[model samples]
Target: MTNSEQHTEHSEHHTEHKHIVEYGKYLFIWLGLLALTGITVSAAGINLGNWTIVLALVIASVKSLLVLSIFMHLKFEDKVFKIFVWVAMLTFAIFIFFTFLDYSFIR
Candidate 1:
């Protein structure tokens, strides 16, 4: 084959390698998150008072982060995207906090 053809082949191969690496990383992350979910569910079954729900939610949040970073490919995304995600999370947190406050203060 010509030199140009050889170089093109090498470039394509390099791109494929990078894609495989990314895919493998995502797969590993997904499996790990799934395992964590199972553990969290089991932990919830145990009696832990008011802290049980909080712990379960925290674990679910971590699992969500794994899905976002790996499955959704947010890890390599722009900072603007990260900011938007954080803002949304903060809004949800505020909503939950206020709801809990209202529940606690109810007569």
Candidate 2:
């Protein structure tokens, strides 16, 4: 395609109107994150042995997902982009799982 054609196509792909997030939604998300933080802190106080780290990681993953989806605008993004992100995250998780597996065998 010519430059102008490519430019027009790209511009068309971009949303003309902005997808504005409502203030109330932002407030709710903020509150949820705050509550999760509190829970994480409370979880830290208890000793769950091997399960402690697992719980903490789970909470942290949830908090990260909230931030990533809302604050990072992943929710508004295209499916292709979201799929790429999930693939990267899955790869990272696999590496982490393997690392932990190796650590378990170390002792």
Candidate 3:
């Protein structure tokens, strides 16, 4: 093979080496998600004013993170990718915060 072709093949093989997650880890994540879902449902039945929404949001966020890391394979991604995810989440939170602020003033 030519030098350029050899270099391309080598780089491709190098990047192909990725983390291999075990089945047990996936099962655990799935089970945790189910438990969180159950808790959220149970919490919904009892009213706690504003805290109900906050509690639901917190649990949803945790479940989302678990899905992102395990199901989406973000756990094996690079640091930059993880940072990007956090930035996106922060931006979303900021938007929600502003929206709530605007809503509260209207009431």
Candidate 4:
């Protein structure tokens, strides 16, 4: 058992354990994203005023989470990476909140 042979075997074993998502599941996710987009567009047409923006943001966040979890394979990643993603999302939310606050004060 040479060093190179052992390294190759270890890598092969590691790759075998990786989770592979099925194509059907991806298709469903795609459909869900499309439906959400349609809902966002339709909601924008209504006269909800300020709440419309909030509704759109919520829908967009859900779509983003779907993409991040499935398309980006974040769901299969380690806990540390998942925590980092959540932290980044939280930071983004804080920035958005501050921007809205500033706009409210200016108005």
lDDT per residue (tens digit) for residues 4-106 in model 1 = 2223234533421122235678678878988998989899899999999989988988898888977775665656678999999899999999999999999
The number of the candidate with the highest TM-score is 3
Query: What's the true lDDT of residue 1 in model 4?
Result: 17
| Clash pairs for candidate 3 | none
For model 4, name the residue pairs that clash.
none
For 1-107, candidate 4 gives per-residue lDDT tens digits of 11222232335434323566789999999999999999999999999989999999999989999999999988877666799998998999999999999999999
- Name the regions of candidate 3 deviating beyond 4 angstroms: 1-14, 105-107
Query: All candidates' TM-scores?
Result: 0.68, 0.76, 0.77, 0.75
lDDT of each prediction vs. the true structure?
0.75, 0.81, 0.84, 0.84
Clashing pairs in 1: none
Model 2 residue runs over 4 Å out of place are: 1-17, 100-107
- Tens digits of per-residue lDDT for model 2, 32-73: 999999998999899989898999999999999999888887
The deviation in Å at residue 66 for candidate 1 is 0.3
Clashes (backbone N, CA, C under 3 Å), per candidate, total: 0, 0, 0, 0
Could you tell me the lDDT of residue 71 within candidate 4?
94
Least accurate stretch of 10 residues (summed lDDT) in model 1? Answer: 12-21
